[model samples]
Target: MDFARLTGLIAATYTPLNERAQLKTDVVPAMVDHLIQQGLRGLYVCGSTGEGMSLSSADRKAVTESYVQAAAGRVPVIVQVGHNSLDEARELAAHAAQCGAEMISATCPSYFKVTSVDALVDSMQVIASGAPELPFYYYHIPALTGSAIDMPEFLQLAGKRIPNLVGIKYTAPTLFEFQMCQSVDGGRFDIVWGCDEMLLGAYATGAQAGIGSTYNVAPALYRNLVDAIEQQKWDEARRLQLVSIEMIRTIGRYPFHPAMRCVLGFQGFDVGDCLLPQPKLSEQQAEQLRSDLQSIGFFDWAL
Candidate 1:
């Protein structure tokens, strides 16, 4: 399918929330400014990092609107409109198109678990049909969705069926399958990598773009890694990727989304905490994360 080639850092952004855990639309402009200043190429809103699944449909639309407006065409915005309810997902995809989002993506419905690759392709085709003009991406994060359909096979099968099937947000760590997906159709699809910690490995496997939750706060580090790869500075790339791995490891010690919010607060923006299902970190826990990050030189590396 014809689509813009997405490259470099695409941050899977977190939703800014208020004290009452409401959608804090006011903070979006500042968030946009911060990301732009940090050298992010695009924003993937209402995705896993943004707590998309935890939000109501109206709230997700509001968040998407806030980001798209704040961006004001400075950078591309890929809105993740996936939901267990295909109707809701279609509504979201249509809303994203109306708001002028650059692209749309969706994960498989795990509630009923897509039984086969054909079924998966059928669901994606239906969702993509919502915004036929925009490029459609299948969010293949099987680890979270538990939809273990073979992605390379899915790409080969879905490529013919879904006319707008542009690519996938490849989050699984299975490098072999990832490579296979990239080789399909002479690598015509935009296979954006999703694992932040293994970004260097993804690069070696020919990933030109990546989207991740950690990129929300530590974009510079990833950008530097990308630059290093471009310059053929393998050692420097390895070192930079190691630093990112260490940073992700540090945040992994706490509840991921909450710890990420805490990190953002340390960097000067308070996006608030993760909502229900993902518990919020206590003040002490936040402080500890700060201390831990400081000890590991996270501030120096990421900032």
Candidate 2:
């Protein structure tokens, strides 16, 4: 495994959208640079936070290609290309690999509740076939996808039957679920935690990387968490965890996708509202997040 493949924080970056709600590819490269400056280990583009579902295939490809080129091999960029359509997901997997994405991941296709685990397995197998040589990580989030892959289901996928299946971004709520994945793999497989609030516990339970929504505002905070663990400062690490959990609670409580885009605005990226159904928060909610940010010294750069 590459050093970039080892453990750290991978921010599921938000897309910079235009006033018309189209992806702003220009705004992406700058954020990629900002993340690198803050010491982020990698980035996960086109995931839930990026409004991947709303983006057209061409748009997602453009964004993925642009970031891969702009990164210029500086840091690992993992592209989330899974969607309702298997063909599109396959295309995305191949596109990402061609564009230099370090790893490719896909969430469970959620629109339908199928008869069995084979439904999910078939979706992954199709995507793997699309990118025959690229390494793949399964995106396991039962809440969002309305599909759960218990330990037995996961083991079936990770077995020799599936080539290019190296790990999973287990987005399950509890660290116990992550611990279970570690147990089945003898604690050696890469499991990236998808919950920011649970990241420390996830890491302690053997997660290699953290993939989260709140990371858009606080990549450095998480990068520090990893370092604290390395130094074995358990108590001090808890302080950072407390700070991060508070932020997650604040962000997670609200309509997340939009509130997050607003914060990105203040930070300098000018992305627009969340796609329909994921509407931008009320003006009051925006100000509240802004105030919360100021209270936490998020604007300290101005000082």
Candidate 3:
């Protein structure tokens, strides 16, 4: 199937929660509306930013359904259904298909660690089989997944094995490797760039699209960056990229995702806190984070 390449910024969305940190899906519609208004091109749900691994399978499905229903076909929604268990991942992929998601992506099982390109292909094959009709993009984040199987080789092998294989959510900083992946099969795949801080580099290296956590709060900044790149405004593009780097650095002072959720709260989302293992910001920390963000002029240009 010929899938239209995903372009522009796709927000790896935050899963809204109430005070109890339970699934507060009632906010999904408002969140979706806000994202669309902010100029994000698509929605990527239940990925690392959404705390997919921490949530129960039931919660993941609920989140998927809420986002899909709220989106109402305004934009494409790509569901990330990666799990440690291949069987559960397959089930999640099928559920995403039934829920009307436009695409599916998954990470290789991280616990046991996939050591070979062939094994990586086989693991993805099991997950891709469940949603054979949806386009599959391998979610490659080696820093988190610990499976740094050579992507160009995996794409080469998996292209023949997985019928719905489309591309990759390439997250690492290796631009050379990313370029090689793009060249595979004469550039047939839709390789969406995943690192937010390095977007300018990716665009210069031929990235048509990007998916990232930071896009949720700062869509306009990235849109401007992409616009500047396309218009050959080299100075403006570099400045914009530096702004993003600074923004990420400020957020990195705390547990990154929780601090991001705090930023979301500042934008009036009521997204609550991240799950237990990820850590949450204290009131003092939240205050400090807000001050830090302000110091960087985040409120001026972030929207």
Could you say which candidate leads in lDDT? 3
- Candidate 1, pairs of clashing residues: none
RMSD of each: 0.9, 2.3, 0.6
Q: In model 2, which runs have C-alpha deviations exceeding 4 angstroms?
A: 1-4, 185-188, 300-303
Instruction: Report, for every candidate in turn, its global Cα lDDT versus the true structure.
Output: 0.91, 0.77, 0.95
TM-scores of the candidates are 0.98, 0.92, 0.99
Among residues 3 or more apart in sequence or in different chains, the pairs in candidate 2 whose N, CA or C atoms overlap within 3 Å are none
lDDT of 1: 0.91
What is the overall TM-score of model 1 with all chains considered together?
0.98
* Tens digit per residue, CA lDDT, model 2, 1-303: 332354577778887777787777887778888877877777888888887878889989998988888788887788898888989999999999887888888986788753367677777888877776777888887788888657446655545556777678888776786787776656545677888887778778777778777776777777777789878899978988887877766766688778888888777778778878787788898898889877866565321
Top candidate by TM-score: 3
Model 3, global lDDT: 0.95
After superposition, candidate 1 runs with Cα above 4 Å error: none
User: Residue 239 lDDT in model 2?
Assistant: 80
